[model samples]
Target chain A: MTIGIVGAGALGLYYGALLQRAGHEVRFLLRRDFDAITRNGLRVTSPNGDFHLARVLGFRETHHMGQVDLVLVGLKTFANHHLPELVAPLLGPETRILTLQNGLGNEELLAANFDAARVLGGIAFLCSNRGEPGVVHHLDQGRIRLGEFTGGLSAYADSLAATFRQAGIPCEAVADLPKARWEKLVWNIPFNGLCALTGLTTDRLLALPATRDQVRAIMEEVITAANAQELSAPITTEFAARMITLTTAMGAYRPSMMIDRAEGRPLELEAIYALPLARAAEHGVAMTRVAMLHALLEAGEA
Target chain B: MTIGIVGAGALGLYYGALLQRAGHEVRFLLRRDFDAITRNGLRVTSPNGDFHLARVLGFRETHHMGQVDLVLVGLKTFANHHLPELVAPLLGPETRILTLQNGLGNEELLAANFDAARVLGGIAFLCSNRGEPGVVHHLDQGRIRLGEFTGGLSAYADSLAATFRQAGIPCEAVADLPKARWEKLVWNIPFNGLCALTGLTTDRLLALPATRDQVRAIMEEVITAANAQELSAPITTEFAARMITLTTAMGAYRPSMMIDRAEGRPLELEAIYALPLARAAEHGVAMTRVAMLHALLEAGEA
Candidate 1:
């Protein structure tokens, strides 16, 4: 399968390298890393194993990539405004677009530009970072939860998941996209937001009892919000506890939002925090903790 | 009048200078600033006027200072654990103690050490900072609200307020101490916490509409919590608006908590954020915004 990876950041490079290694033609749309990637290819250092692609196709402009069978968007959600123009040149009539961006409204943004049926939503459960210009570090967990934005399993999503699974990336297809987003949010909103706001790692946050309770409170608020939105994905107190345990086991991981903040980049506040908060507000679910965190992040950005 | 000024930071020095100028014998109990203050006296650069005392008394050890008519406690609330020993040397049977620190439970801490009847509460509505050792910059506003801890007017409180007023500091005596603390908190919890957490000054925070709304929301939460605790100081929506307008006029003032954080000093989280939050929780008022902010501040301190 020929695939085009947009926004060649850490996740884009990690997944593109794996897909390319799996015999799929994966082309990366580059920006600042264009020269480095084109000259040295992409190098991925993962706990699973290290792989270096010495020769790979890279493009500075989207128009040069032509059409592909699938377009995997790994851009920060803050850059989604450029999608209509960037993704236009790479889309065929049946070119399925899978957005692996963090937060709530990426698929909707893509669906507004491309076909709704071809716009798939995905949550990357991978701990990864771009170490250098063309190097990706996969710390742990390389799972992708994929689903249709409008709900239910799609043939394209299933096939893509199967391909990802074949590449040793545990990809799961879900029937409910909103539910999946909320479930991801149950973890994302608390961990990512707190890490960015406090500049603390996952282990540090879980180490303190007060902060641990705060994380649980934030997760419960997300679950209440999801239930209020009528999206049922078994998000419960037990699930929240499981998330805490899981993060505790992840050792000392710095979340993506924290990395964005550390690198002086704009946070994915609109998609990750504001969108879900607005939905929750519409359903009369007062996510005060999340709202305060969102406000602080927004203030910091300003 | 004999006055012993404990905690020779900005507020302590500013008030001490004014009291000395007003013909009261004011002695400062210092720590790191002991030598500078004793050698050079205390220099206050104020918008109102510049004044420097060349022969002020300073003591490194609390025991070196004899008992006085009044002991003005101006230490950061985080250092209140050493209050019993520090204030013991300066307290007589009727050496009325007035705590001029920020946040709730300060009067209670003083009351625990000294006589409950002699423990007075004060809210300093002054913008001041220690520019250097023995040097304080008085930016604006030198009014203080004075009240009794047990909640009523007393001769000691009245005389203290009169003394402060005579020293060119506008001091008002109030009947309800807890109400005064809550009223001050309606401003402190939001502005101080937000400024410290976001690293944004007053003007920047007020400049953005979203953050401005957040400030208001936080103030409202404090008001709710205050009302829940049965302390009614007329902290209404109108009062909150007045506070916002007042802060807007203050330009780009950095609250004390922000200054403490900038100087790498531990924040007074226990008194300022935790005590009030615990009280609100016991009263069944969910101060979720303040609680989250408190947690973030606590984490940052950790």
Candidate 2:
């Protein structure tokens, strides 16, 4: 199957390289490095070693993007406002769109821009960031969970999962993807928000007893609101502890929100923290810590 | 009257120089800069002008500090741990110690280290920092509030106020000093903690609307806890707005806590934030923002 990866950032490059290595025709749509990649090729630095593709289709202009069997959307949530422009040329009659981005409301954006039948709900659990132009760094890898919002697995999703598995990337096709998405949301709103607002890494934050208790408290507020919305799962203290361990295991990888803050880039503050806080408020749950975290970020030095 | 100033940071030098200029003998107990002052002199730079005092007494050895009529304890709260060692050499039959430090529980530490009759509560509303080895930059000038910690003003308090007034330094001798201390605390815990954790200046922080609301929430929590402790003065939203205006009026001054965090000095996190949090917990008042502020400081990257 031929695949087209939109927004050739870390996640897009990782998916493109892995699928191309599995003997699938993969093309990357990038705005910045298209001319360079069209000349030299796409470069990826992974734990396995550096992988370079000498012959890959690089689309600089969206109009140059041809038909594709699948399109993996990997842009940051801030780029969602431009999704229609990005996916315009790639959406063939049978192309399925799989969005593996962080935060909520992206699927709605995609569905509004494209056909709902072509939209797939996905939760990506990978530690990846752009190392440089046309170069991607895969930090610690995790699986991607994909499902249909209408609650059924499509043949195209199974085929994509098979290709991912063959390429040594973990892929699961779940029947209920909301739980997975909400679980990731619960973990992120506390850990990423706290880390970004305080500029502390996961291990040091968890080391302080006061910070650890706050991590749990913020998560509890999220869990309470999640339970109220009937999208509840077991987001316990153990879950928070495990997340801290997992983040530490990623080896000094700063969360994307922190990275944005460190670079003075506009953060995903509203999408990740404020949206959840608003949701909690709607449910009548007191999200004191989460609200304060939003306020801190909105008032951030960056 | 002879005066001894302990922990001669900026405030101590400002007041000591003022007292000396008013024809009173003043001395500073110095450790790091005694040789410099003995070789040259103490220099004070203010908006008005710069002045030098060549006859200022500089004592490196605590044993050299004989009894004085009054002792001005103008140290940071973190340095108050050495109260017992520092106060021993300055104590006499008529000696009284006035504390002009930020934060709570310094009086308790001083009272525990000295006789109750000799310990007086005080707060300095000035903004100055150490400029050089023998110089202090008086950033902004403000009055001092001094009174008995146990209750009611005594002769020592009246004389201290008079001495400050005569030196062209404003002061108010109050019947209750703890109330004044707690009022200052409501401003410090939120603004200082937010600045320290976020590394932003006071004006920049208050300029952000969300941060302003967060600081207001913190003040409300503090006022609730203060009221729970039977203190009548409430830190209302208007009071928070007044503080925001005051902090903005001070220009781009970074909180001392941020400076300490940057230099890896032991933070007065406990004395400034944790003490009130503990009190709030004891009173069963929900200190939501204060609790989160404390958590953020504990999670500070520095």
Candidate 3:
């Protein structure tokens, strides 16, 4: 199956290279010249040595991205405001688009921009960072879960999973995708928000017992809000704690939000932190920690 | 009467100039070549134009400041750790040392280093900043409150107030120093800590509604802690609100603690913030906002 990847970031590159290695035609709608790929092709440097894959097609815009079987949107949450312009050129008659972005409100965004039936709810568990234009540093936890939205399981997802598995990338087709999305959110909102606001890495933040407790409290608030919205996943309170422990175990890894802050860019504070608190408040759940943390971040902004 | 002015920062220079302008023999125990004084003497540019006072007797070491009548320690709180060395040359049978530093532990530290009878608690109402070394820009509110440790009044206190009044600096000699100290603490401990940790100026921080409420809650906690310690001031809850209003009324200014942080120097976190919370906990008073603010500051440190 041919695949078109939107937003040639670390995630897009990781998936693009893996699928292309599995003998699928993969193309990237890149923002800039991924010269490293144009020169030496894409490189995936992971804990399991380096995997050099060649001849991954790259496009500077969506206009050049021809018809494909699938499109994956991997842009940052703030960059998703222009989704219509990016997703329009890649949507063929039955071309499915899978969104694996962070924060809430992203799937609704994709659904609003594309046909709901042709959009898949997916979440990527890979920890990757853009080392350079065409170089991606892959860390632990590389898995992708994709499923259909309210429709029966389709052969497109199955073929994509098979292609990914053949290329040594873990892939799965879950029957329920919203739960997976919310489960990923439970970990993202709090830890990312706190790390970004405090400008500390995960281990450095958790090393301070007070901030560690704060991280735990924020996760509980997210969980409460998710449960109140009647959206939860297989991730229990125990699983959330273990996820935090995993990041703490990683040691010295800076959250992406911190990277944005260090680069003097506006953060995803509204989407990742404040919106969940607003959702919790809508359900009349007392989320004072969320409220106070929001206020602290606001104060820092001032 | 001969006087020694230690710490030669903005507060010390302003008060030293005022005392010298009032016909008191003032000697500043500062380094020999402080920039502003060395180049242009001490220039205090205020509402009444500039007063270039060149009467300050500057010394590089405490040994040159032989047996003075009053020793005014106007150093920053972090500089108070070396009080024994700074106070050595000014100690005499009749010398009274005044401390105009912020935070709670300074008085105790001074008492531990010197005789309590010679230590007078002082709170300066002046808003001054160092435009350059030895040059103090006095904005407004140049009032000073002086009170002795003992219940009995002293002639030296009255003499000091008379000198200040003659030099156009407002001052009052209050009988209850502890009350005045606690009242100042109610404002300083919270607002200063918040500004230092968040890097927000006074006007900007109090401009936000949530931050304003946080400041009010912190003041309430500090006052409650003071009452628990049996050192409550005459200021009521309404008066504390009035104090916050007054702080915002005073222009945009970052406290010394903030200046320290901007300069990448070690903060007075223990004295200004942490010790007060520890005292509140020891006194069995609930300091929710104070504790939260301290936690946020500690998180920022990490």
Model 2 per-residue lDDT tens digits across residues B131-202: 768887888856798889777878878888898999888898888786777778877888778888877888
How well is each residue in B67-108 modelled by candidate 3, as lDDT tens digits?
A: 998888887776776777888778898888888877667767
Residue A71, model 3: lDDT of 85
Task: Report how far off residue B193 is in candidate 2 (Å).
Answer: 1.3
**Candidate 2 or 1, higher TM-score:** 1
**lDDT of candidate 2 over A1-302, digit per residue (tens):** 88888877778888888888878898888777777777887778778677888877887756677888888888778777888888878777888888888877777787887788788878878877777566778877758888875566677677767778889889988766666676677778877777777777767777788887887787777777766664525446576567667766775667778777777777776567767677777878878788888877777744
- TM-scores of the models, in the given order? 0.96, 0.91, 0.86
Per-residue lDDT of candidate 1, residues B80-194 (tens digit): 8888899999887778888999888888877776678888889988899887788999998888999988888888778788889899999989988888888889889999999
Worst lDDT 10-window in candidate 3 chain B? B31-40
TM-scores for chain B, in order? 0.97, 0.94, 0.91
Better of 2 and 3 by TM-score: 2
Predicted structure with the largest TM-score when compared to the true one:
1
How much of the real interface does each model capture, measured as fnat?
0.76, 0.89, 0.41
TM-score of chain B of 3: 0.91
DockQ top scorer: 1
Relative to the real complex, the DockQ score for model 3 comes to 0.40
